[model samples]
Target chain A: MDQRKDDANWSPPRQHLEIGDSPADFNTGRVQGRRLTGPQQGFGQLWQKTYKVAIPNRTPEQIIATWKAEYGRFWPSNSRFYAPVTGIKPGEVGLIKSNQGPVPLSTGVLVLYSDDTSFSYMTPEGHPFAGFITFSAYEDEAAGTIAQVQLLIRTNDPLYEAGMIAFGSRAENKMWEHTLRSLADYLGSSAPVDTSIVRVDRKRLWKNFRNIRYNGALPWVRKVRSS
Target chain B: MPESRIAMSVRAPKDTVRVIDIAGELTAFGEGVLTEAYEDADRPGVKSVLLNFEKLDYMNSGGIGLLVTTLIRAQRKGQSLGAYGLSDHYREIFSLTRLDEAIGIYDDEASALATT
Candidate 1:
């Protein structure tokens, strides 16, 4: 859409996930938007739904297969991987087996992978894309294997900062968070991998952004604009 | 101290340049910088802009918007703009956002200065 028109309506989402160290019923003040200050001095543990994704169903093989087939389409080619095998036999036989592609791209904007690892990447312009951390389950000598994927996201829309974050007002942060949560909900527990968002230290994240350090924990973060 | 800081540095080459050290999580800060920078630039037609992203670690979609806005503005004013350093993950973000299609990126201080 046009710039002004896009910016005119729709503020950031302000919904909050059930995160807080309180009695599960404590308000903890406003959940979405900025001013998400916490544990409220003694609010217990202050938590935001930074990453709480419910992975979809299916198997790891199936999920990886789908990603290899089309996940690259939504993103650039850099997000893909390949596994190849080549060997020489005893006397005069040679065998070569190799597979390469995206690890089963999700049916939504979220990215997916089957390996027991995660990655990080950025836009050439500096915008961070939603990256993810992966967890894998293997059964019986590798015959049965399962995979879980998680994504970390933040709202990109400018209207929901709500004065919580320094950039866009809380309103923008609120809307963006809501949109992302909605996207996460839509992806649900239908795919082979489970995805979630986790809040990392912002300062640490910045350090990581500059290539000076990495937390080695959180995977990816993204900006979501309301459609 | 709101967020962890990165290692990239945006320094002044001639001491005549004015820089803005933006802090906060970029997911939302991107919009804030765009709004304020556009309003503050020398009334359209000024050159030589440097964004000290040393404090920015993670930039979401809003961060992309903020950079895009800055790039476009600079292009209009015949300015030289270059982002010197970014976290390894942010590099992928550049590719994801396709900012390479719009502006230029440098690896460190000297290159950013030389390009401009």
Candidate 2:
């Protein structure tokens, strides 16, 4: 499939998110009707993080195919991703129930792009980070085939920004590292995962402080506290 | 399969504006050239860095990510970023990614330059 064709692999423009036939048992409603946000719209300092692991026997296409099919299974134990019935195609919305602090954070991601060797997710307005997370597999000169995840993101709001600066960043890093390790293990490789983080911008967008109003975890935390 | 390649050349249309004429597929493979081109166009006294996408043939999600990074770099330097010559499809891409909010998009180079 040529990526340049009109509406080829890119998700169509959407005004609000809409969930498809996902599991009914999972908690929902935080993502529906929310607008998608990119790193440019986020509040905190921009950062680009990359995590990679080499899988010796698998081809890049084979790795991506498995990753897309078993996307949720590779996540850490605390996270649950409910992919749509149509799988990880462009424009598909996937619901997520993940832990943020002690409370459950219910949000979702839009499949922004997908190809044979790579796929990307864009977060909704209230996701912890506003940006794109791309999972790809490529053939490297030194390593036969490398599976990688790269994120270009910033915290969605001031509170999330503070949380990220405090401890959330470390947890996020560990989560991805665990994911890569799991993927490598699943693919029958013991290669060590390599990680890199770069701060793309130092300044925060103070204007987006109001985004805290849509924080998904805060309401749950407050409700638990008040009860 | 042929390798994807992208090239960017900096042109100073005026003292305050530098335009980057981009060609080829703007993917992760083009990061080095894009960064170098951006730095070259981001010389002192240049307040606006506009991208020319007339010759751009293909772009993937990685390309969109690169654009966002470019936008951040421009914002950090206090320079405005704009783009022109995008096909309707690519323009829609900019909208989908919400990049249209931060970077000005124009139909042609003349219109983009006229604004600056």
Candidate 3:
């Protein structure tokens, strides 16, 4: 059967991420069975960030194809994205190893949706931000093909919220900027990335303060200090 | 291809639950319609709001986020919410995202509407 015809770009369902019996890596098995967390479930104020680059001669489909194929390659080098064995199709889990200032963090994301022109990922429990980041491309009559990444996120816990206020925000901004710049460079352009941030909600959800229990930094701190 | 358009209508069915009927695709750009519909339905004395996905054919992950956001807001406002008419695919999506744990999922309209 042609899965594309039946599913129409949507992902199938899985109760939990089945990490199976893979050899131990940094944090592959941690997020294996954890549930996905969205921005609303987080404790901090909500934010929507957009990073975009204008691709002069490319079509939206072309840009999206390249973005999906080389998604991990466009990262900022220091971070690692382990694409799932089945690739970035919807419902697959991708492991991530990144840092916040001097702290090494490990987490993963679920490929929630994937289509020709766009794909979105949902962060798992214990991730710094409970959120969704969408990568997409579209034809803008004025700007040709617009390759963009949009993030709607909220700090997953009080500790992560404090980190964001310190240096995490800047580090995150640079990371995505680097990604967009790399994508533009990959497509044979050097256009400066455009970034915009919006505070979608100013009030924090104090009710979610307990989310600190899943903070990845605690385990990371313990692991690093012991070694 | 034509851009997807989202349309929503809110009406009380059986003089009980307020049903919000959603149609067309739920994408990032189409979120405003869902928001507006929820706003209109979330009035004083409305005990529960049921989202009718019968006419909703396509919804991406962003749309699921939008639904989750709306559910959070509605619950915060003390208005209980439920949904019906999701195909098995979407039902699984809800399960995968753990949205099934957050929102009540029903098989069809009759069973959903028949409930309190």
Candidate 4:
């Protein structure tokens, strides 16, 4: 009772949003994104995390033809294209770009796997790249501008998995210093890469999501591999 | 760390050339290995340079960018740049970044040198 009275006198932190001030931007998604995996679906419908691939200033149209023409020949065995992506329908590959908040995938080969086995092949380093942002929309739901992009990769991104398991642990240091720098550059982080070795684990990834998820700015993150 | 490292081989007039390989993760020192190999080019008049990556694992973006920078410098001095022995993953990064498109890449060092 005494603690409750003390709490009433104090104001909430400015950085943290209260329930009333919460913006309509937070979202949670799984692999394949909110995209429909098949043509038919109902209450039991399955959705996959979808991402839009974009490169700063490199328009999709200009690079699409050359991408398919040059590297299309190297698509994986089960995959129609080496760069697995999703949009449109099967047997089609093109550069997709939408300014709308509905997706994050832009200009890579959209892969449609017969089974989910592709996850095993995806390297941890192959986390989605390009400049696209993410957002969510569903039946009877209003879409809002996003501050973070939470997602799940369908493939087994080894480093991503290990990094999570080894979060705050020794594996963080095993990475090249340049990776941190590259991410810093990618995220426009002012902090230098290798600022300090992180010591964390599964508990850390879930508990302290605020810091790990885009340094408390953009919530865009692929939370886990399995989820 | 990848269990294996890329092997180095030379195929110019065998008597006139030496090669040092940069394979697996291109660490800070990996960059040095590459620079030294070229700087310490044994034969002053060596006509070709081979960056053999066979059994190679991966090259970080810095390494990729380094390759690009090196390609330009090598060409300026009339030396041909050859990159071979890329794994599927590295090959993807190279192709996606258009590094493969920008530079000449062969499947093997022998092919690279023989052509030169």
Q: Over the stretch B59-101, how does candidate 4's per-residue lDDT look in tens digits?
A: 4333443564465556556766667777655565555444565
Ranking by DockQ: 2, 3, 1, 4
Tens digits of lDDT, candidate 1, A1-227? 11111121111221112222322332222221111111111111111232222334534444444433332332222222211111110111111111111111111111211121221111011112222222222222332333322223322122111112453323323433343344334434432222233343221222123321111111222222222
Interface RMSD, in order shown: 16.9, 3.5, 4.7, 24.1
TM-score of each: 0.32, 0.95, 0.84, 0.33
lDDT of 3 by residue, A12-43 (tens): 66645555434366666458787677776788
* RMSD list, candidates in order: 21.2, 2.2, 3.8, 24.2
Tell me the docking grade of candidate 2. Answer: medium
- CA lDDT of each candidate? 0.32, 0.88, 0.79, 0.33
The residue ranges of model 4 lying beyond 4 angstroms of the native Cα positions read A1-227, B1-18, B27-29
Model 4 lDDT tens row, A61-136: 3233333233334222222222223322222223322122212322222222111101101111122221111111
fnat, candidate 4?
A: 0.00
Per-residue lDDT value at A187 in model 2:
91
- Write down the DockQ of candidate 2: 0.59
User: What is candidate 4's TM-score for chain A?
Assistant: 0.19
